[model samples]
Target: MIEVIGLTKRYGGKTAVDDLSFTVRPGHVTGFLGPNGAGKTTTLRVILGLDAPTAGAVTVDGVPFRTHRRGLHHVGALLDAQQVHGGRSAQAHLAALARSNGIGRRRVGEVLAEVGLADAGHRRIGGFSLGMKQRLGIAAALLGDPPVLMFDEPINGMDPEGVRWVRHLFRSLAAQGRTVFLSSHLMTEMEHTADHLVVIGQGRLIAAEPLRAFADRGTRQRVTVRTPQPAVLAAALTAAGASVDTAPDHLAVRGLSAEQIGALAFANAVELHELATHTTSLEEAFMEITAGHADHLAGSR
Candidate 1:
């Protein structure tokens, strides 16, 4: 239950986030995706109040974060994995945090176990590996048992086993009616973990909808049309307002449907042809939507 409206942030002459708006609903895992410099981190900063927005507003559960007396009880976040003190043990670290927040000591152990870090609770955080630290940060976030959770690249340093564990963890949390908002550049993880997706680019919102909805706009339908005069068939189809690109052995049509192109060929006194249709992939769909930003990102180098 979070809403960001017209969220704009700037640094010097560069706009980190420009008029971004979106809503995170309960009972679902919403994936926030974008290219490297697409203002994802800045948006999170504005939402968390880590950085004030130049223009716009963000609210948690319909109230501004500053007004909630016990705001953290309803919202938990893991902004960075390395914020823990290096020399302190995991238990001590969580205990210290719980004390400041007036949370019980028992919650420390509960979150430790929940994050699969119970046995490592007494170990020094400095000695812990990257993945272990990530788990520890997650344990801290869950210590409050909040209804809303925000994680920025939770799987960044995780191994395959840890990644799979987090996948199930987010799903289970959302299934229990929690709002899980995650921002990551990892497309594969988003494909598996996110029921809804909010994608942005160039500091602006791009598409926000069910993952399947964005994927259904793909243009990669494969069509195979066979004709006696292949060259003439290709030319006629191109003239009939179809994007005719030559394959190694066949023709690829982009705009016009195979049926329409075939009919045009027939009208032009062309011979009959065989046609077959194929489907594209979710990854392809993502690329198509972010193509302009992807190209710009590439050109920046």
Candidate 2:
């Protein structure tokens, strides 16, 4: 579990994090989200103790990370895959990390195998592609055999197969009872990956709740009805108090059930070509929520 209490940081006059507070519990994946320069990286730095907070504190499992017994073994993170020394072999790189942290060589092999890099362990990192670096970074994180894991944009710079693999990997890690904290710019990927979301904007917390709740709040269930008498159906749907919009061959409608639309058509002796319910996609919901916040902030600005 990671608990952040009134975590704040300031660089001279600019406040990066303004008295932020949140609890990241284990047994689930928590997503950290924000736009560029929205203090996400700074917050992660504070949490990992790489940068000191101006006020408040962050703890891993009831204690600051520096104070934890086997601190590196308790929390593993892959913030940047490119942070590796380019000249070293993948195996040599992980070996050095294992040695520095007093992690055993056997565990090194396990992690390398775990991330499917066992064969490439002898390969130099400079020669590896972005996808390979991602795998190596993951191997480094798991070297500690930690129960808590944190990743910042773990899926960036990967092919379609790599993206799907990472998604499956995160899900697999969560299922094994690890506390996974992920920060990704891919809203749709996050929607499918994270069990909970902690959204921030302008260095302030915007919303923190179950992923579904955030998505649901931005979408209204709508029904689409198509009819040959499109012009006729629009007026009838409006008279019926359903919000109606004109589609080329259909009436995109809201606040009406499929049965009601069918009944309305039947009563009016109207013929229909198509009738369907359209569920809002996750991307749309994210746009609606974040766009609303942006507009609100701009209005004030």
Candidate 3:
């Protein structure tokens, strides 16, 4: 498990993280989300001991990451897939990290195959495409077979197949009782992959909860209704304190539950064909909750 408590970091006069606190437990894929310039990179750097926190602390498995002699065996991370030396082959790069962590060379080959880079291990990293580099980085992170893994945009340049593979890999790791902390800007993939979420905005904690709970925080609860008598149902729904948006075939309703709508329709003798609730998507909830915290907002052209 990873625990970040009262964490704060400042660069010169600017505060990047402000008293942030969150726990990433084992056996779950926890997603980290934030708008641009929200200090997510800073927090990840501090957690990996790459940058010192101005205040508070971070610990992986009950101890600071830097205190471990074999850091990879305790906590493995891929902050930037392109940070490796382009001169080295994928096998060579992982071999070096394994050696530093007192891991055998055989583990390097295992991880390379695990990441679907067995055929490309002999090629130089500089010649690899962005997607291939991402695979190689994942290979390195798994080299030590650590119980804790942290990845930042691990699917940045992956193809559709690669993206699916990563989703399965993260879920598999969490299933094995490992602490998996993933940071990505892709909300759709995150909604599929993550079981829980830790959201931050402007370097402050906005939410830390299960994915469904967070998404349900969105205010736009809607119900879709399909009926043969669309006009009758629409009028009945509107008169019962619900806003109705009419369509050619169906009506989109707000401010009423499916049960309540069904009951009202029955009372008004309105025949119904379909009634379904549509909760907010992860993207919608993210936008709604962090609408005010975005540092960079785009204007319509």
Candidate 4:
């Protein structure tokens, strides 16, 4: 588990993360989501003790990460896949990290094969593609076989197969009762991968909740109904306190559920063709919550 309390970071006059407090528990894949400048990376840096917080505290399990006797054996992280020596082979890089952390050199081969990079372990990192570099980075993280994992955009530059493999890997890790925290800007992939979410905007917390609960928090819920007698059904729905809008061949209804709308149509003897509820997607809800929270929004003057 990871615990952060009243976390704040400031660079001179600018605050990057402000009064953030959250706990990432075990047995779940928790996603850290934010726009480009929302301070996701800054918070991760603080968690891993790469950067100190101006105020507040962050701990992995029970103590600050840097204070751990066997730091690499307790937590593993992949902040930047490209932050490795270009001249070194994949095996050499993992070997060096293992030696530094008092880990066994034999673990290097195990993780390389775990990440599907066993054959490429002897190749120079300079010759690897972006996707291969990502795999190599993951191999390094797992070299410790740590219980806690933190990754920043692990799927970046990955092909479809690689992306799918990563999704499954996260799930498998969490199922083993490990803590998995990943930061990403890809909402679609997150929707399928994360069990919980921590959303931030402009250096503050927007929401921290389960994925299903967060998506259901969307304010706009509508029921779509198709009927030949649109006018009659619309009148009945309006009388029941529902706002209705006309589409090409259906009525878009607010303030009601699909079952409610269907029952109203049936009581009014209206012929119904189709009835479905349209709940907001994760991307739509994310955009709505962070509407004006972006530090750098793109637009033409």
Q: Each candidate's lDDT (Cα)?
A: 0.84, 0.83, 0.92, 0.89
What TM-score would you give candidate 4 relative to the actual structure?
Answer: 0.93
Q: Whole-model lDDT for model 1 versus the true structure?
A: 0.84
- Tell me the lDDT of model 1 at 264: 79
User: 84-132, model 4: which lDDT tens digit per residue?
Assistant: 9999999999999999999998999999998899899899999999999
For lDDT, the strongest prediction is: 3
Report the lDDT tens digits of candidate 3 across residue range 1-301. 9999999988877788889999999999999998988878889999999999999999999998999899989888998999989999998999999999999999988999999999999999999999999999888888888999999999999999999999999999999999999999999999999999999987889999999889988658899999999898888888999999998889999999999999999999998899999988899999999998887322200
Clashing pairs in 3: none
Residue-by-residue lDDT tens digits, candidate 2, 1-301: 8888898788877777878888887878889887666677788877788889899999988888877656568989888999999999988998888888888888878988888889998888999898889988988888888888999888888888888888888888888888898998898899878999888776778788888888888787789887889877778888999999897767889988889989998988889989999878767777676764442222110
Candidate 4 lDDT at 59 equals 94
lDDT, model 4, position 2:
96
Query: What TM-score would each prediction reach against the true structure?
Result: 0.84, 0.91, 0.91, 0.93
Residue 246 in candidate 4 has what lDDT? Answer: 95
Candidate number with the higher TM-score (1 or 2):
2
Task: Give the candidates in order of lDDT, highest first.
Answer: 3, 4, 1, 2
Top candidate on TM-score is: 4
On residues 263-294, what C-alpha lDDT tens digit does candidate 1 reach at each position? 77778887765777766666677778887875
RMSD of 1: 3.7
Q: The CA-based lDDT of model 3 is what?
A: 0.92
